[model samples]
Each structure stands twice: as structure tokens, then as C-alpha cells.
Target chain A: MKIGIMSFAHLHAEAYIQNLRAIPDVELLGIADDDAARGEHFAQAFNARYFDSYAALLSAKPDAVLVCCENSKHRALVEMAADARVNVLCEKPLATTLTDARAIIEACERARVKLMTAFPMRFSTPLVEVKARLDANEFGRVYAFNATNQGEAPLQQRAWFVNKDLAGGGAVMDHTVHLADVLRWYLQSEVVEVYAQTNRILYAKEIQDTRVETGGLLMLTFANGVFATIDCSWSKPPYYPTWGGLTFEMIGERGVVLVDAFKQNLTLYRHDLKRAAWNSWASDANQAMVEDFVAAIRDDRPPRVTGYDGLRALEITLAAYESAERGEPVRL
Target chain B: MRVGIVGAGSMGVVHAASWQQTPATLAGFFAESSHDATRLAEKYNARVYKNYAALLNDVDVVDICAPTHLHHDFVLQAAAARKHIICEKPLARTMAQGRAMLDACRNANVKLLVAHVVRFFPQYALAKQNVANGSIGTPAVVRLARESARPKRPPNNWFFDFEKSGGMLLDLMIHDFDYARWLAGEVETVFAQSIATENPDAPLDFGLAILKHKNGALSHITGAWAFPPPNFRTAIEIAGDAGLIEWKSADTAPLEFFLHERAGDFPDVGLPSSPLREDPYTTQLQEFYDALLNDTPTRVTAEDGLAALQIALAAIESARLGKPISLAEARA
Candidate 1:
């Protein structure tokens, strides 16, 4: 399968290229970027072609196009790919608005093309094992969970990431979709309502900076009676030195299961830190997600993270934005 | 190597037991001028000091396990008498007092170590090892929580006085704060919120602090002395670019050490039953003694204690003023 990339702009674009290159079943098709310089850089680095325009890449009609564009651009890219009858693996936050998201889904359906939201977190081995354990009542009755999403303040890196119009919302929109989607996937339930608050206490940028807060706190109630919270932010200072990953605690009726997907440790203890290391799921989460996305393309299968799932998570992010803006809970 | 413990409370007992079987001598015990010194003296097989001056002048190393309010005076006196010192945490109520204690020890050329025992905990030590070995990559996010159910009857009434112990931030949360600072580094800024319920008539027992280091790693710490039962739960999750590492005291059952790393295959990193004894206090005392005897450095230095205390105080000040507090602001 020749998997060409649509943008080098999305943060995970490099990972997409590297993973695609690593898989034997896939070939690296030329990449397209709005900026010719970036496209040329990737082309030279990866030994692929460079296109200055999205239309030119579509005309080449690669087997699949990885839509690594911003949320606002997802809709147009998906529509263009569907019209070209090209399959798509869209980066998360499927769309900026519900209308555009719904339209993309309809276009993909009408064109009979495979459309997948690249939510590779679902493919994480530890998370999948956690899901299995939760399903088998390994940890017991599901109670509450605490999830955190922290990264470098985006505003410190680029001005557009903090711009509400270009990026959607700040940290909440940027991060919660992934966490929310993972929560939904793990719980196998819908998010019924959300009460969230956001502010720009860290990044002093003025553009759609609603999402570029020093920190964000959220309370979510899933339909399956599982309660979860997401403390999201780009508030980590430079000196502390860390990257982004997921660490969470799940309380059940039988026992509590603490799983860190990024860390790939699923430890079950009798009750304290002094015990032995339990069975830990050690598969590479990101690689697993990427492999699944590629397999879906090759086998005519739907992705582990469907476009609908991404839309739902995107809805929650948007709802959180509305709630923060209106100072009220936004019901899903 | 005779050791004189200046408090006969629970921690004092822990300390006394740690020193008794070791090479160090259990010189005697002392109580606040008001407490029942004679009763405690009888239980511990030691003499009672009616006068702290007599105790300070008598013992080779004066361990200040006294309440926070008494820490400053006792340490100063021990230093004046040229006694080696190991004082309990929050070295003093205020940074100024802490500095004074440091100055006194320096002037007297006495070996002074502060008991930041968390670093010596086998589990945290292992967690530190993983981070140092690039197991988690460069840690981007650190979420640490230390929560305990409020004591049914807090020992000293002075614990409620803000001027005495520096409130919960110093008295209880300082453990997590110190550990976070040690694991992370110098915190450049802090934004915090706290609650002191009038019904309890106590200092702030529950709160959250967001700390930023100069290196860009963000730390979220939620500490409470107001849980429902006598539970000591502490968990740390560090997310790095390559992987994740976490520790939860409660997840390691039957044992007291809780350290978990992302492993492809299980490696037996089991901890031996206490290094010198089952008590960490003994290990601490042994380390201090070895450092002095061998002309090495103490594991938990006075400077480490001071940095931890400074971060704790910064969190408190942030909570007090309802804003993000900076270390620069703290120094000013």
C-alpha cells in the first residue's frame, strides 16, 4: 500500500512517516504540504516526492492519504479525499464543528471510502489489556478514574496552536479528545454530560486562547456509571522535563487496577506499593495503533478508532468549550 | 554515637527503635516541658531530661523529633552545644528559621541531616533509578498525590495554629512536596488553591498545587490530611518521551515498597527486607553515621530539606493569596 501523507504540519506527522516506513506492507508515497519548504524537507529526508498543493497529491491518487492537518482542515481534506475516492486516515479531533464532521462522515459513506480517525491510543497494549481486565471483572466493579494530560505550553512553541480559529480550543480541545476517546473506548459507554472550566493562566497569547490555559479541570460521567476526570494542561515548566503520556487509576468492586499505557505497566496489588510487580502489558502503544491503522487500509477493515468515535470525543471537547464559555454544564 | 531523641511521640518511637539496635547509643529521651516525660522515659528504657539544655549538652547527636514549633530552638541549641543533628522535616516553620538552623550547624561544624525519608523509601529510590536510567525518557509530567485520613485526634493542639507548623503544606503535604522537588528539581513557580474548613477549626487540610520547574516539567500535587480513614496513599507518575514510569504505595500489596516500571519482561527487582532494619529511620540513621564516619555525604542533606521546604512554603503562599506564586516572588 502506498501511504502518502497530506500534511507535515500535524505534530505526529513525523511518527506517521517513521512508522509507515518501518512496516513492510506499506510504501512511502510522496508527501504534500501547504508550505513547499517543509514538503521538500520531508521528501529529501524520507526519499519521497514533494508536492506543493493538496490537489496535486490527490491527482496522483495514492492508495491512502494520512490527513495530518489541523482540526479545522479535517473536513475539507476528508471531503477532497472522498471525492477523489481515496481512503483516509485522519488525525484526531476529526473535525472542528459537528456540521463539518457530519458532512465528512456522509461524504465518506457516499463515496464508499474507508475513513478512520487516527486514535492510536486505542491500540496501546496496556490499555487494551486494561479494557480486557475491566471487562472480565479482573479489577472489580468500575468505580472512578483519574486521568492526566500534560505537555509543554503550545503557545511557547507556536502562535497558531493557541489561536482558537486555527486550532479549535486550547489545551482542553487539544488533549481531552484523546483522553475522552480512550475513556469511552475503555468504558464502552457514551459520555452523557460534562462540566469543565478553562482559563489562560500560563500562556499569555490572545488568539482562540481559550484552550491554552495554564491548566484545565473536567468532571465526566459516562453512561456506564463510570466517573472519570481529566486534568489537562500545557502547563509543565521547562526545567521539570517531561513529555506527554497517559497514567490513570481504575477502582472496581473487586480491586483497583492501575495502568499506565505509555509506561506499559498493568500492576495488580493486594493493596500497597510494597508488593511484587504484577502482569504488565508491554506492547508498544503507539506502534500498535499505527499498525492497526495500516492493517485497516490493507484489509478493507474499519479502524479501531472510528470516525464516529472521534466525532463523539470532539463533541465532548466542544461541549467543554461551550461550558467554559457560558459558565454552565454542557449536556452531551 | 549516643543518640538523644527530644520527642517521645510516635515518630520519636520510630526514631528511637531505629537507633537502639544499631551502633549508635540511645542516650536518653526528652519531652516538652509540659508532657509526661517520665512515663515515656520508662517505656523506652531511657532517662528523662527535665531540662533540654542538659540533654543537648549530654548527647553526641541530638535528633529533633519534636513538634515543628520547637524545631528551631532545639536545633539551635543542639548546634550551640556542638552536637550532630538529624531534625524531622520542615526543618523549621519559616525559611528564615530554616536558614538560621543551617547557619548554626555550619558555624558549629556539626554534621546536620534532615530526615526527608521518602527518598530513602526503597520504592521511590527505585523510581528514581528508572528515571535516571532513561527508562521513562525525559519526564514531562509528574502527578504526585499524598493523602491521609485526618487523625481522629491530632496530637498537639499547636498543629492547628498556622504560625506553628506552616499548616498542612508543611505538616503533611511536605512529604510529597519534598519528593516531587527531589525527583523533579527546583520549582520556578507555583499556582495553588486550599481550603480550611471552619467546622474542623484546623489549618488547610486539603488542597492542590500546580508547580512549574525551570526545566519545563509540570507537577500537579494534591495533598490532604482530611480523608475518611487512616490511609496513607502516595503515587507518582512520570511521563517521558520514550516511555512512562509510575509508583503507587498501595499497588504493591503485602510489601511497603511500591515501584513500577514499564517492562517488556519481568525482572526481579525485589527489595530486601529493610537495609539495616525493617525501619527506614534505622536506615537513615545508619546512612548519616556512615557518612560521618567515612567522610562521605549524607543522603538527605540540609540543603535538600531546605529546597523541599521552600517549595512547600511557596505552595502555601500561592494558596494564601489565591494566585500563582513564583520562587522569585517567594525570595522577595
Candidate 2:
């Protein structure tokens, strides 16, 4: 049950540290980031041991590692973890390219360890409820999904989110993978086609150095004949209540279901803040996700969301990018 | 001025109610045989005409709320009678029909207001105005989803026939299609997917469409006939650099009552309504009436309706063709 965090590059590590703390059996062994200052800061802030480097942390023989590195850096970190015979819970997009995603999966397979994508939304309470109903055929045959995974540009907390090289792409690359994995899981089908359009509407001028799309609309067709659109955008303003939210309306033959996963919140207007803010009281999907990651290693079984799932999602993001460039639908 | 509604179905009853709130008088309603239409006519202290021609003869303005396939004929007959027209959306089932309806109205020198009611919705109008006025800077991405309960209809009902009703895209989603264009000038391309069910009981349909606007904006629109009645939902999120505007029917409603013994079998009762004082349909009809009185122009002109229809048709074509369709190719 010993686990180490690979990098604090992605902000989700801030929450993951607390999530791992809540688990009874899982020990958050230590922190490891290439940036010594960052490694020392979080290790002290969270009251954990600090390692000089990711390699040093891996050599310490932690059972598993959580890779919260930048989008493109996931492959390197994951490959590094696999080389050390460690299981991995990698952050989303899996990798910038389909080849890297496939290679990561193969490397993990060869090393005899599981690689799980950090798609926490798969464990989201409300979304999980919907999936159960869908699996039970209570929603009849789901026909379409209208979903959005939107947020304010992660410029302040993680500048790498907007960096084209580090993040792979912008909003589409950053957000699309979460729902893509969920859709494949719910529909039990792989995406057959991807048609997408991206825009530099929100942060083009603000982040002039990096040329990346801040907004994207994607249309996807599943093998089961289900169709969906994902609005993955960093469109929330800085003054908004929180980062943003994930919302969807699922259409089915029996009935329609609407999910606003992050809607459980109280609007707080504090004197210290300039604007109103939403204080969400949502059940922690991240906590459940990490728990599953730990359970998989303990049971010596595959994680609920696997490396192939990550590969499938990565394929979607890459196809979306290709389709947007060619101004057409890219067939699988 | 007097207003008579044609094909007294759901939209007919709604338009009849809206007309009663205006300065104009309610002339009557014409349907093949609609019990609800008779009830609505009685409630408004109006007649239920046995024939379409008779209703057109009496009313100053003809409000066509018939099936999609019948709009062209209804509009043509109304225009021949030299009556001003208020037509429910999709404009027409086909581009040719929409263009013909526009030409007929123009040649007759009668005012034609394609009743795109969402434009008159205060929230939607305000959101569009905010985007135009730079409240959100340059509008990058517009996202919208409209969900309506699939009301039970007779097996022979025209609404059950996709050919007659033009399916969910034309019947339900054309509203969002119009709104998307209103928010982002004109659409240059459309890609879409649809699920058409064969279940005799529900016969539900769901559609998703993506529009790339000429203004460098992208819009995602979803239309569904799946939810339970009174559980109808609408959501919009327009994101730009300066800010974001988001709203949902369930969230913004002034009242919410989750009755324990409610919401199955019997559907369309007291729906969750927001704090808006006047009904949006009333506002739309009144504006059209005033335009006819002043000999000015309606807010949603026939050309605008045609344009929205063109985009909707393009989406339908995209879904049918399994390809990304340019607006020009769709029009051709």
C-alpha cells in the first residue's frame, strides 16, 4: 500500500495528497518532483517525506506512483515508473500522441503492472448512478450524449496547461479525454469517428506566446450508433465562483437524464472576496478513484479504468485535433 | 387585429394563449380534430374552426403551428388570403419550402414573423446581447441543449413520422440552431449525429450538432425528445475571454417541488418555471403584432428563419451523410 506522487506539476496532486490520507491502508510514502523546490514545499506542507528526484523515489520501492505531470510528460513519467516495476495512476490525455499512449500501455504490460488513467469522473457519484441505470437498461437505449467539461483556463495554478508543448494542445486536449473515457464506458462502444472544431476565443491574447485553442466543440459517433458532442473549453472567467463544472444531458429511448456533477454547492459571498463563489459539497470522486487504484494493486487485478481505456481516450483527443485541422470528420 | 392558430397541437395552444395576452383578439383555432385545441379555444373564449380556410378568412394574422411538412401549405394559403403570418420554427422542412414560404409572403406584401421564440426569451436575448456587447469579449464557443419529454402520440400521428415532422433536429433542435446563429453571426459548416428509435411506445429521437460560425465561433447544439414531461430542460454556456454566461432551467427555476408520488405516467403538469413575469411566447407574439401594426419589421425576420433552417438542414444532412457538410454544400 505504499505509494509515491511523481510530480506536483498538475494541481490535482494538491487534492490527491488529502485523498490518500483519508484511506486507511494506503500510505502516501513521499513526494518526488524534478523541481527540488516544489518537491520540498509539498512534502513539508503535507507532512510527508521528500525525495530528491522521481528516480530516487522510484528506487525507494513504492508499490505504486501517481503521475500528475504535464500532458506530454505523462509518457516519460509513466515509462519511468514501468521501468521500475511500479503500477501507475496517470493523469489524463494519457499522452500527446496515440503512439505514445500505446507504447505506455505496452511498457506497463511488459513490466507486469497495471496503468490506470486518472479519470476521476468515472467514479463521480451522480455519473456512476447514471451508468448503473444505463447498464440496467432503465434509461432504455441511450441515443445521445450532450456533455461539457469546462473550466477557467488553468493559467494561474498550472501555467503548463496553456503551454502548447507541455500540454500537447489546449482545451480539447486538456478536457476531452475525461468524457471520452466515460462515454466509452457507458456506451460499451468505441468511437468510430471524430469531428471537431477549436477556437482561440478566451486566452489567445492573454497567452500570446503559446498558440493554442482555448475552446473546442467535438462530435463523436460510437459503434453502437450513439452520438455525442463534447464542449471542452477553458471559458470560465477568473471572477467566477470556482474553476468551472462538468455537465451533461443524456438522451435515451426510455427517458432523458440530466447530470450537473458539480452543481452541489452553496453560493458564498464573503467580504474578503471581490465576487461570489460556489463552495461545492460534492462527494469526492478523486478519493474513490485513488481508492480503486490502491484496491487494484492489492487485489492483483486490473483497475476499473485501464491503460486501454486511456489509449481509447487519447485516440479521441488526437483524432479531434486531426479533424479540426483538416476541417472534416476523422474516421477511426 | 385578430390572430387564428393553425393545426391546434401543443404549439398551437401555446400560441393561442400568447395571442390572448396581446392587444390583438383571438379569432379561433383550426385543427383536424384536437380535443386540447377545443379546450384551449374555450379557455380563450374563441371558436374552433372546422377548416383551415375559414380560420384564415377571419383572422388578421395566421399563426401556423402545424406539422413541419404542412407549414409550406399553411403559409401559402395564409399569404394568399393577404394575412400577416407568424410561423413556428424550422421555417420549413426543406430549404426549398422555406425559400418558397419567404417568397410567397414577400410577394403578397404581408409581414412574416418566423416565431423563433427563444430569441424573445429574456435570458437568451440578454446572453446574446452580452456576447455582442463584449460582456464576454469575443464569443469563442456557444453551447446549448434543449430537452423535451417525448409525449405519447398515436401510432398514426404525423409527429411519429420523421418524414412529416422532420425528426428531432427540425422539430426540437431548430430552436437552438436559431439561437446559436443569433449568438455567433452565421454558420459556415455543420456536423451532426442522430439516433432515431423504432420503439412503438416511446419512439424517441435525439440529435447533436456542431456549427462552425463564419465569425470564428463554434457552437454545439443538442436536441432531444426523451425526458419525462415537466422535466424539460435547457442549458446554455457561452464562453469568451472577458467572462462567461451560464444558465440552466432546473438551476434558475423560481420553484422546485419534488413530489414523492409524482412524475411518472402523467407528465406535463406544473413545469419548473423561472422568475420571468411575462411568458416568452407572449413577448414574441406581441413583438410580431406591434411590427405588423407599425409596418416595421419583426425581430426574427423570415430571412433569419430561413438562415436558421439552412443551418439546421445542413446539420441534418451531415448526420445523414456521416460527414462534415459545409453550409454551401448543404444548400446546394
Best by lDDT: 2
Per-residue alpha-carbon lDDT of candidate 1 for residues B145-183, written as tens digits (9 for 90 to 100): 776644444455566778887777787778877877777
Per-residue C-alpha lDDT of model 1 across residues A1-332, encoded as one tens digit per residue: 87789987786888788888888978877899886887888788878889778899989878888998777888988898899998888987898899988998999889988888888778776777788877786754565666777666665445666766777777887788888998988787898877565555454433344435545666576777565667776655433323445667664444345566656445555455455443545665557677777788778888777789888998898887886566445678
Candidate 1 deviant stretches above 4 angstroms: A1-70, A74-146, A149-173, A177-332, B33-36, B154-156, B198-204, B255-277
Q: State which candidate has the highest DockQ.
A: 2
**Global lDDT of model 1:** 0.73
lDDT of 2 by residue, A137-239 (tens): 8976677888889888888787788888999989898899999998999988999999899888688877764568888989888898788889898888878
TM-score, chain B, predicted structure 2: 0.93
Interface RMSD of each: 9.7, 1.2
